[model samples]
Target: MTEAPPDRRRAGISILSKLLAMLLGVSLLSALVAGIVGYRNGTDSLRAAAIERMIEVRESRAREIEAYMDSLRHTIILDSRGIAAQAIPELHDAFRELDEEPVPASEQAAVRDYYEQTFVPELEGRQGGEADVGALLPTSDAAWHLQASYTAADPDWDVRLATNDAGDGSAWSAANAKYHDFFRETVEQKGYEDILLLDDEGNVVYSAYKGVDLGTNVLTGPHSGGALQDVFEQAERATSVDTMAISDLERYTPSEGRPTLFAASPVGSGGQASGVLVYQVPMDEIDGIMTSGGAWEKTGLGRTGETYLVGPDHLMRSVSRGLLEDPEEYRDQVVANGTPRETADRQVAVTGSVLLQPVESFAVDESLRGRSGTGVSTDYRGHETLGAWMPLDIPGLQWVLVAELDTSEAFEPVRDFTRNLLISVAVLVLLVSLASLLLAQVFVRPVRHLVSGVREVAAGNLDARVAATSRDEFGELAGAFNEMARSLRTKADLLDEQQGEYERLLHTLMPEAVARRYQDGEETIAESHSDVTVVYAEIVGLDDLTRDMSSDEELETVNLLVRGFDEAAERLGVEKVRTLRSGYLASCGLVVPRVDSARRSVEFVREMQRVVAAFDAQHDAALRLRAGLDTGTVTSGLVGRQNVVYDLWGDAVNLAFSLPRANDRPGVFVSAAVHDRLRDQYSFREAGTVESGTGGSSTGPEPVWELEEDSRG
Candidate 1:
């Protein structure tokens, strides 16, 4: 090389600068190419993974919803074939007799006032329109009487409307007393909003919850042309028990205009379809399935992800998770997205989105067209989202399930990866030709250790931890990752403990067999026993004694007596059905049949007498127990939706309750059937006779017998 001036050398570009330029160019070029290629592949993979996850979740939810509909169909068919067939004849007869009985003008006026003041206003408030109070008024004498006594006369009619008795001593009241518990329990246990029994004439013969629809004739009544009437007519035309009619979810004025779905099946006996059994499907269940009980995260639906049902009308069938998680945000989003402010406000007010929030989206349109796929589309909230959609397989329901996640959340990891890769590329380009080996040794080893630990944690080894050998960013990341794994482990343990507690509480609330049936997804628990004994014990003075005591004192006294009764009944092999105020109902052979049911029931009653006697002597209170024992065929099962109770119904239970009140004195009495069963082993004398044709099978005076003072097994 010739000696040259520094200015001339610089101007000509030095060899060292040339080599540096080439190295920088190559390094920057390679880094840029790698970053672009890696970003494209990672984003494509992430998008595909997100779509696939959405599809999987959508399919799973759809299948579950379809199975739930199938279960409802199966349940309706089975329940219709059960008490509906046997109960219709007696209920119809009683209904007819009540029609013949004259309705007092005062009672009819009370019913009319109830509609005007209570029912029509509530219906209008829920359905969002005016209602004709006169149109909904009972048109039949029986309707007037039943509604007057059961629906209007009840002071807490809105609260405890499921109560079956009015003590009005009418033929319909008698019939209601006989069969109402069975139907009421059915509604509760099966999670039915209500259960209605309709005769072949479309007359709503009985209502489980004693709503305004209790005695209305669906064919000619105010609700004649509605979904109830349609489903009733379809079910009436059914030739077999398997044939059923399912109504779409609609606003039902009778249920306060809540979105209601009805499933109806023919009720038949002896090859004759005599009536229709209708079940109001509960909204909570469908919503629970869609929202996974509001645990969207557990279903892999991260923040801003949710699944919901869209009906044929483009209205939501299930409640929106947005409404539940963030009501104010939901309101603002919905109002901004073409939903009227008033409508959105109403949905928030109702704490529901069903049949109100309109979803005019491409996903819903495609789903309605019966085509299922995954894509990016604008959601109901007007946010661009990754969605998977499918039409539900449930019959008579043109509903589609759409699972969606906001694109912002779905692409978050890709965004992070791109950003992190860009930074890494810039660093690599700058340092590639300078101290490259040193950088690899210092940074690459710690990154590899961190990556290995991340892989271990990703593979479910939560205990896998890397040592933070140096106080660098990589070491801090390792420490953070380890903490995250520990937190996840703690949360998993908490979830397990919560699940165990839930299982324990379930078992405590229900009998072992019933609890297992519930676990196995059996909703209704009614069963019939051909031969059984029921004991009804009334603590005559407890109410009077408790009247003077404070609420806590009264509760303590009641608990003490009930606890003692429960202990004695358990020891004597008697299953206590439930307690009503001061009355305790128990039976043998109700849950587990026993051959010596009558004897066990009698012994149980004697123990109850002793329990009351001990309390009277100890507290110097006149707590007398008058118990009645009866042996006959009866139906028994678990009832109620939230606070479940075991109940017994039939001629046997009715007669057992009637025996104690047959006489003025408080003593242990047995039904004629019970006395006949136990007379040989225990002493008995004729107590008195109670008219038996009220609602039971007996047509004449039935003799009541008293258990002698010295009676023993």
Candidate 2:
């Protein structure tokens, strides 16, 4: 006769199997969650870091450009001061000494002779010796003769005429007659290119050269419409000592391109405006400071990044990089009809503060207000750029000193870092995941074998044994399993009796269907029908009850309550699932059939009330049991591996939980879904809807009906 299968076999479970299952499940879940969270956090951190870095770059550029503008202002101021010192003394003396004196015909003839022979020879010889011979000569010799004739006509001609004959008889002229000669000679001899003496009303009194006419209003000169003339007028109106001014004259020269910096200082006599000592420096010269000392090439500053000058009227007066070769072209491309290239100009104007890499271009018209410095980044001339703008304090010109660095160049390092960081992160994730998977397989292989062996043993195969491969924990576990299997084989004859005891234990611990599911290694999903109902019972104030008790005592009381509820549910042919402390989740007509889910729910409630009353009668401490019931189709399944539990899900389960909280009367509260299913068989009080927490929607008021114990059939 074939030997009967072993009944118990110690349930054939090794500690290693439990430990491995727990570890794998927990590790996989933890790693997956951690990876997702880490990726999100890493991306957020990178984006924030990028923005902060860009802001810093913008701030640095703003400070740099501001310093550059200050340097340019100082250069212009120093030049003005130098020119004023040289011209002011002579101009004041000439104006102050003007007088009318009488002269005889003989003295006049002598003065005239002295001027032509001594003074004229000296002036001609001086002009010839000068490096710029053409600078001293007018286009027409007639202009020179007219000046000489004017000198000869003066009345006090002989008194101030300097003679080479040492007071001997020579032609002479008044001091006023020599003034024009002195003015022309001084201006040319001093290397004052393009000199013009202006009267108080801003009219050109005389010109060293004839191409530009004298007796013309300086304000209406060809090169006088722009900022240059404005600076001159401002200085003429000033009452201060030797006032100075600087401005940018746009379109000054049509061919040489771009604007020029017009720096001038007042030449005054005893508080009366005499003339302006003006100097014109091409705008490129001031902007050259950025490229000076070979910083641009040496510092890896790209050609796309350049420094430029912008007028207050939103016009690019001068630019470097030769990208936009002409000032007009640059202005046309960026500022069309006096509008800014980007919207950031509005912000810069409003804030009057620096915006670092604002991702937009700014307008000089708006951003040049009130001595503020700022930076912005935007598409300039169709190319991405990082630009900084600071107000240029040229005395009479409203302009901004602007510097731009191409974004691709400025953030190259950041781009490389981001690329490398992403590459590194990808590599790390790949390596980690690969290593983890390999390690898991290596670790789980032995455990799987041991589990399979134990399961075979539990299935009545006493011959099942584990292979002892290595000397680690797994090897030891395998050896222990083998030993236990051998011992089980020796007791094979007494297995029939042990099988009865094992069945009794299983039935005591769990319902028949659940025990069968565990035995068969089959997952069970408990389905609910119209005739099925779910009940959720919870013990109130359980947390407070356990606070004062020892851990073991707390556990014992919790287990007792859970066990009692489980027993009651099982007796009524309901599947009970244990939850957190003081709560038992169970469903009727899930495993067993019922006529009406509401009636079944009522019966379940009545039974629970009877059990609670009996227990209260026996014990001094009355245990308050609150039960909630709801009838609907619910999905129930076994969840977890080691500590497996049969759980119910869906809106039905949520409503069931809400019902108990809605109940004020001590017994059971049934949801509308439940009440409608069995309203004829069971009577209930209309409690209406009570706000309760469920369904992931905040605590909501749900319709609940109260069922008293007496109302149950």
TM-score of each: 0.60, 0.38
Worst 10 residues of 1 by lDDT: 437-446
> Which residue pairs clash within candidate 1?
none
The most accurate candidate by TM-score is: 1
lDDT digits (tens) for residues 597-617 of candidate 2: 456556766776666666567
Off-target runs (Cα >4 Å) in candidate 2 are 1-217, 220-226, 253-258, 290-304, 320-377, 386-395, 401-422, 445-713
lDDT of 2: 0.54
- Which candidate comes out best when scored by lDDT? 1
lDDT of 1: 0.84
203-310 in candidate 1: lDDT tens per residue? 778887777887789988767788888798788777677877999888887787888999999998777898888998999999999999989998989998999999
Each candidate structure's count of clashing pairs: 0, 14
